[model samples]
Structure formats: C-alpha cells, structure tokens
Target: MSEAERVPVEVAVGVLVERDAAGREGRFLLTSRPPDKVYAGYWEYPGGKVEAGETVEQALARELREELGIEIGPAHPWQTLVMDYPHARVRLNFCKVFDWTGDFQMLEGQQMAWADLPVQVKPVLPGTIPVLQWFAAERGHSGPTHLD
Candidate 1:
C-alpha cells in the first residue's frame, strides 16, 4: 500500500490501578514495551484496542490478564483520547480498576512499575501520557476532563 493510502490507525485502552503508598494514595501502574515491538523502549499504560464483538471492559480485562497476569474486576470508564502517530492513529480508553486479583507479573516479558501519576519521564506514549497526567492531577480515573 502507498504510504499515503495506508491506514494508520490503532485503538488502545489503559488500566489505571492505584494503591496507597507510604500513607499517601494515588499510584498507577506503567509497563515498558519490549524493545522489539512498535513504540518499544517507551513507558506506556498497559492496554490494547477494543476488538469486534468485545466491549471496552472485556478488552481491558483481557489485556490486563494477558499483559500483566492480573485478573481485574469491574472497571469504569475513565477517559478516552485519540492520538495520531506517523504510522497510525490510536484511540486510547483509560479505565480504572477498583478490584483485582493475583500478583503483578509481566506476562509479556516487559517491565512493570507502580508510580505516581504525572510521571517525570520525558515524553511518554502520546495517548497514554494525557491519561497519566489526568490520573496524577485527579488522583483517580473518574473525573472531569479539565486537562484533555
């Protein structure tokens, strides 16, 4: 396909799970994409697109289980951001999980870390950063879209 004709598009969702740290709450999990994949080496929220026949919640639960080996409970809509990249456009839905099970383990051989939102890292994945900042500012996923 021609470069201009190629459809550069993708859909992804991010899971925002927080925990109390040192008596202060508001921490989210981020994972590093493997060096061999697209946007690799950059830190990103763990999620993928919503596939046909599957709801957003289903996609989020599946992605979390597949990528992090954690089984998530009910998740509520957090935020949605559409981003455009050189190769594709991504519609990212950020979800918040109030409950889950299992230890946080990397099912895809990626590195996972729980950090305070609005991370200090320079330039995170375009779609994921916005939600991250929202999480940091609000200290949760459910809130108004003041920073979008």
Candidate 2:
C-alpha cells in the first residue's frame, strides 16, 4: 500500500520510571532495543504495543514485566505522539511511573540506563527524540525550538 493508504500497525505505550537522587536531578529509564528488532540498539522508554482488548496502562505493565522484569505502580499518563518510521507508523503513549517493584533487569539482553536530560546514549529512536525534548521542557530546561 502507498504511504497515504497505509494504516499504523498499532498503538504502543511506554513508561518513564523515575529514580529520585538526593542532591541531583532525578533520572528516568531508557532501554536499548534488542539486536533483532527494527531500529536495534536505539534507546527509548520501555514499552510495547497495546494488544487487542488491552488498555495502554495494561500494556505498559505487561511490557515492563516481560522486558524489564519490573512490576509498575502508579503510572501517570503524560504525553502522546504519532510518528511514521520506515517500518511502520505508530502512536506512542508515554507515561511517567513513580513507583514500581523488583530490581530492574534486562530480560531481553538489551542495555538499560537511568538517564537525565541530554541523555548520553547514542542514536535514540527518532520517535523518542521528541519525548526527550518534552521531558527537558517539563524539567524547566530549554528544549529545541524550530523555525518554520
């Protein structure tokens, strides 16, 4: 199908789980995509596609458990964005999670990091770049401004 006729594959949800650091800016989680996945090695907030009959929160919880081995608590809906990649168009629903259980583990052999703004990870997924900018703005930092 042509680009105009193509439908987005699915709506995906992600969680930014924060770690409050005393006397320092708090950090949020970012995960590297598995080598086998499209956009492999790119960093993004942990989440997965919302399945049939599942709410975004449900998907976030499930994905975190399966991918990171953590059970999420008190996830607050934050922002939503629609992006079109070469592989598929997607709607990303990002949530800010303030609480959770279990030690964070990379169950999928993916790298994990707790990052502050201006993340050190190289090559973040294009769709996630905007989220990072939004995060910076929310933290009272100046994000990029575009001139059209």
Candidate 3:
C-alpha cells in the first residue's frame, strides 16, 4: 500500500518530566529500547502503542506501568507527530507526566535515565529526537539536543 493509504500505528508516549517546588519542568525520563526490539539500544521516551479500545491516556498509563513499573497520575496531552520509519509509520501522542508513584523497575530489561536539554544519552531513537527538540524549544535551550 502507498504511504497515503497506510494507516499509521497510534502510539501513546509518556514524557515524564520532573518539576521543582515552583513547578518548573526539569529533567525528563528516557529508556533504552530493549535488546530484542527494533532500534535496540536507542534511547526514547517511555511508552507504547494504543490498543484497539484504549484512549491515549489509558494507553500511556498502562504502558508506563508495564514498561517502567510506575503508576502514572494525570497524563497531560502535549504533542503529536507522524513519523514514517522503515519498520513502521506511527503517530506518537506525547503526554507530559508530572505525577507518579513507585520506583522504576525497567521491567523489560532496558536501562533508564533522567535527562535534560543537550541530553547526555547516546544513539537516541529517531522517533524520539523530535520530542527532545520540543523540550528544547519549550525550555529555550540551544545546541545539539543529544549525542548521536
């Protein structure tokens, strides 16, 4: 099927950002793709696809719990992007998550990191680059967002 006719997979992505006492956004979370998945070792926000009957918020909450072992609070809808990758086309629905309870477990055998602008992680996933750029824009950050 042609690109126009192909339906993009709807994914719910959680941008888990830390906030200070004054409510200023700070470092967000990133997770390395599990070893067996496509683009493995590339860092990206924590999330997964929206299931057949789930809304973006439901999917985000469920995915984060399963992937990171944390029960998220409200997932404030942030941004959406359509990305066409070699493996699949996806519509990423990013939500700014500020409140959550529980320690992260990295349930899928992936590594997780809390990162800020000019992210210290390497080999970021292509699907994740735009989210970093969005964070940079919102924070008035200038420079390469992450290492290749």
Candidate 4:
C-alpha cells in the first residue's frame, strides 16, 4: 500500500482503576462515552490515545486529566484489546490507576458512576466483560495488575 493511500488508525487506551473509600474495597468508576462519538452511549474507562512523543503512562495521565480532571500517580498495566471498527482499528491498552494526587470527578460532560466488585459492574461494553471478570477474580484493597 502506498503511503498516501494508507490512512492512519487511532490507538487509544481506556483505563479501569479501582478505589477504596471507607472500609469498602473494589470500587471502580465507569463513564459513558458521548453519543456523538464513535462508541456512543457505551460505558468505558476514561482514557485516550497515546500521543506522539509520549509514553503510555504519560498519555494515560494526560487523557485522564483532560477527561476526569485528576492527576494519576502509579498505574499498573492491565489488559489490551485490539478491535476493528467500521472506520478504524483501535488498540486499547487498559491500566489500573490506584494512586493519584487529587480527587476524581467528571471534568467532561460525561456521566460517571462508581461500582463495587462482582455486583456493581455490568458487561456494558463488549470488550469490558473480560476485564470486569478479571477484576472480580482479584478483589483486594491493594492495587495490582490482574489480567488473567
């Protein structure tokens, strides 16, 4: 394929991090993707593409800051999904962000909902079920990259 004939595909990473408030563990946050966008009305983790000249962590932090208005600290790499959409194929590199500087909120106009393990989350997105199962298997207060 010629360079001009080839179109660039977008690579985005959606992070699924858990937090514990009070004595309850396995608290995860989910946000709905805008209806106007590609994956409209679908619930997903708040993250975006790995931009040029930026690492995965850097891109994840940048995207989270823009999406949730929170500064994430150490994040553990999780599952990766390569799906083919009608327009393009996206490489979703999921991560678990446990440590951060500030509190998390919906910076964008998207809706945010918090869920606990096993019962709180649902298979909203097609690719999210596997990740959710992985999260459910490893319910703990401590943070670790659990991708089974």
Candidate 5:
C-alpha cells in the first residue's frame, strides 16, 4: 500500500474502572494482554474491538463481561483517540466506569493491576500511554512522555 493510502482504523473501546482508596488516591484497572496476542504482556485498560453493528457502549459491556466477568454500570463516555502503531491503526473510545457488578476475575488468564498515576507498570501499550497521561493530568500530575 502507498503511504498516501489511508489505513483503515479499527474502532476499539477501553474501560477505565477506578477504585477509590480510603484517604488516598484512586487507582484504575489495567490488564496484561494475553501471551498469544499482539503486544503480549503489555498492560492496558480493559476492553476490546467494536464488532459490526455494536455501539461503543455495547462493545464495552460485552468486552467487560467476557474479559473481566463483570457487568459494567454507569459508564461515562470519556475520550476518543486515534493512534498509529506499526501493527495497526486504531481509534480508541474510552469510557470511565464508575460502577460494576461481580467480583473482578481475570477470565483470560492475564494479570490485572489497579494502578495509580505515573503507573509503575513497565511497557504499557502505546495507545494506552496517552490515556494514562490524561488520567495523570486530571490528578494534578505532569503527564510523562514515551521517553519517561
């Protein structure tokens, strides 16, 4: 394909579920990509690609149930970001999930973590970096760049 040819962008949804710690800062959930998937072992918000005829919300709900074994509640549409990666271009639709039902489970056998700003997790997915920066900015912290 020519450089000028437009690359098709995959529409993906991301769920940001934050947990408020008593008398401390809140933390958001991040899951490790399955070993067989692209960017294996990279941490990211819980979500998946939007299927045909599915709205962003619908996709989020389905993904959460399948991946985390929870029914999402009160998810607020947050941000839309388009990022280019060597593997694929994607348009990410992010949602801020305030509530959910059921105990969190790593259904896909991936590691999960509740991370605070300036995430201590190494090698987060490139598409997720901007979202983390935004989250940090919301918490009054300077966003770190890829080099940080």
Candidate 6:
C-alpha cells in the first residue's frame, strides 16, 4: 500500500439547513470553492479541516464563522464518509446545522446558494455527491439531485 493512503485528512462539513415553521427541512446551504483552492467553482457544503485537538463540531463552527461570517447554533451529528481524491484521502464529517445568527457573508470570495432537491447548482463537488444522495433518501426524492 502507498504511504499516502494511510493518513486521511479529516474535514468537518456543515450542512446548514433551514426549517419552516412546520419544522420540515427546507433549503440547505451550498458554497462555491474559492477560485484559488482545489475544485474551484464547484459547489459543496461549507466547512473545513479539523485541526489538532479540535472536535468535528468545533471545526465546523470555526470554519463556518471564518468562511461565512455566521455564528452557528447546535450542530446535529449526521453522516461521516471517507472519499479518495487524487490529491488526498479525506474523511468528511457532515453535520446538520439548523440555526445560526448573523447574516450570510462569503468571506472567502465564494458564492453561496440555498437549494433543495433538483439542486440548481452546477458542477457539484465529488464529495458532495453522496451527500445529495443521502438527502434524497431522507427526503424521498427521486430524479437527479443536481446538475453536472
């Protein structure tokens, strides 16, 4: 086995969701990758790596605050998936965040969109595809989840 395969980068992902008064999950947040970063322009959930001594939730909060300029509320633990990319193997920890304070801001010079099934965004990130499927299953949605 190759040496690089042994260590996976741990990332904390925030699936920020909005719920209606009836409490049904509504629109979720998607952010375009920064132009200077990998997979630039591809849309994905917002979050970043879990630094040393930081928990997934901590990382999620920090990343969201730094990247979006919002203070997130309780983050419900969701799914965890490990994806193999050519550049690095990443363990993505996805958390569903339903409440937050402050207005949205693209602090990283990225675009943010709120969308539901048949997600209107184009060029979804590879790691984000499974998340779409997860959402589909939970929402009982059929058909394509997003554009290629």
Tens-digit lDDT track for model 1 on 1-148?
5555654344446566665655444566778887777888677888886778888888888888888888888887878776767766666767777678999888787887676633655336666667755655665545432223
Structural similarity to truth (TM-score) of each candidate: 0.77, 0.87, 0.97, 0.73, 0.86, 0.96
List the pairs of residues colliding in candidate 5: none
Q: Assess each prediction's global lDDT (C-alpha) against the native.
A: 0.69, 0.78, 0.93, 0.66, 0.78, 0.93
- How badly does each model clash, as a count of residue pairs? 1, 0, 0, 0, 0, 0
Pairs with backbone N, CA or C atoms under 3 Å apart (clashes), candidate 1: 8-88
Q: Alpha-carbon error at 13 in model 3, in Å?
A: 0.3
Q: How well is each residue in 44-141 modelled by candidate 3, as lDDT tens digits?
A: 99899999999999999999999999999999999999998888999999999999999999999999999987888888988889988888898888
lDDT per residue for candidate 6 within 19-105, as digits (tens), equals 999999999999999999989999999999999999999999999999999999988989999888877889999999999999999
- Cα RMSDs of all predictions? 5.3, 3.7, 0.8, 6.1, 2.8, 1.3
What's the lDDT for residue 49 in model 1?
Answer: 68
Score candidate 1 by lDDT: 0.69
- The local lDDT score (0 to 100) that residue 89 gets in candidate 4 is 56
Cα displacement (angstroms), candidate 1, residue 47, comes to 0.7
Candidate number with greatest TM-score: 3
**Candidate 4: regions farther than 4 A off:** 1-16, 19-25, 118-123, 139-148
Q: Measured by C-alpha RMSD in angstroms, how accurate is candidate 1?
A: 5.3
Q: What tens-digit string does per-residue lDDT give for candidate 4 at 1-148? A: 5444545443445455555575444567778776567767676677877888887788888888888888887767777766655656567778787767776677667777776544343326665655666775665424423222
lDDT of 2: 0.78
Instruction: Check candidate 4 and list the clashing pairs.
Output: none
